[model samples]
Target: MTDWARFLPLSNRDRADDGGVSRDRSPAVASLLSAIAAVLDARPDLLAAPTLRPEVTVDAAVRELLSELGAPWWRRWARGVGALESPRPEVAAFADDALASALHARAAALAGPERRASIHDLRATVVLALELNAAHGAAIVVDPLLCGAVALDLALRSRLPERAVVTARSLVATDGEWRVGRGPELPAPGGAIVLFLAGRADVPPEDSAH
Candidate 1:
């Protein structure tokens, strides 16, 4: 017996009341959740009031899981985002550029120009960049107006609606700056643009970006 197998009965019982459960009760979901639970248990501090502080618990759980999985520092840093959590409007705009940079990085790594780019791969790269930026409290800036719209679109679409709500406004470059809202003047064309998404402590307005 796997740890997940042990929890299947309980999960089934919980679902029994609602017409005996659906795919939600599938073994894979149970196993993954159980594994996450085990990881959280190993860190009591993160296990604090999971029901009351689900986001906090999730953040901690993700961080722990990333560490346990031996993910790279960048990947680990990016795990701070919770599903369904939205990025700040300002952050979303900046993320467009960052995502573009990540995409470019991926493109550059390919052996040949003819190597096709998968939207999924590009989206994953951007997602990682988004998480890393949030965790480090820093912004990423790519060179002037790199395919930002496309990158942002892919990143936003790639997110699981049940898990995260990342969104962004249109990015318009004028005099070498990507502008969003009246928050502050964007950096110069060649400078870095910081993202201050929703969950970040420094930003205001707690509405979900969905």
Candidate 2:
């Protein structure tokens, strides 16, 4: 399974309709990605946390991730954000079904066909990056230290007031206290999701078969 937490923070602060463009290399995004990568490289079991840490708020973590990776497209797009985003038909044409589904989901939520499409494309790109990392035999782990209970609480309350409290109660009860790192092995279910913010998932085909 892939880590979804690392990428969760990158959700645009402003919906595309409101002229919110997400930076691809913000310090916040970079930091979060770095933290994830560091933990993955050392241990592959920390992905299972009761809740993320206080400092691991979705936006802050995503900005940190953008900073760590050299990719500046997100930053560029965010700065030039207008009613429309750049067209990426070729990208859309190339994505697979799972990726396409996710991309379509984001596109439908935002405004501006191009911007919406771009959001979907970017999600696929992130997924591909994780695939490459896994193929390389890189140890994958989640940062148990980053707690997200508070942020999740706020998000649930704001987005789904009716279900937020109930959902939060369930997650908090099922998951224990969030911690620092994981042991040698992760404690998640088989095929659990890993929190991957960003990395080089688009590796060359030839290079992938190491």
lDDT of 2 by residue, 107-158 (tens): 3333433332222233322332233244433343322212232223222223
Best by lDDT: 1
What C-alpha lDDT, on a 0 to 100 scale, does residue 34 get in candidate 2? 45
Q: Which stretches of candidate 1 lie above 4 Å from their native place?
A: 1-109, 137-141, 150-210
Q: What is the C-alpha RMSD, rounded to one decimal, of candidate 2?
A: 17.6
Give the top-scoring candidate (TM-score). Answer: 1
Minimal lDDT window, size 10, model 2? 189-198
Over 1-210, each residue of candidate 1 has an lDDT whose tens digit, in order, gives 213222121222344453732322122222332333343344434333232123543343233322323134354345445522233232234322243243233334343434433333332333333333344322433223222322333323333431132223322233332332222333222111212221222222332331
TM-score of each: 0.26, 0.24
**How far off is residue 65 in model 2, in Å?**
7.9
Backbone steric clashes in candidate 1, count = 8
Q: How many residue pairs clash in each candidate?
A: 8, 37
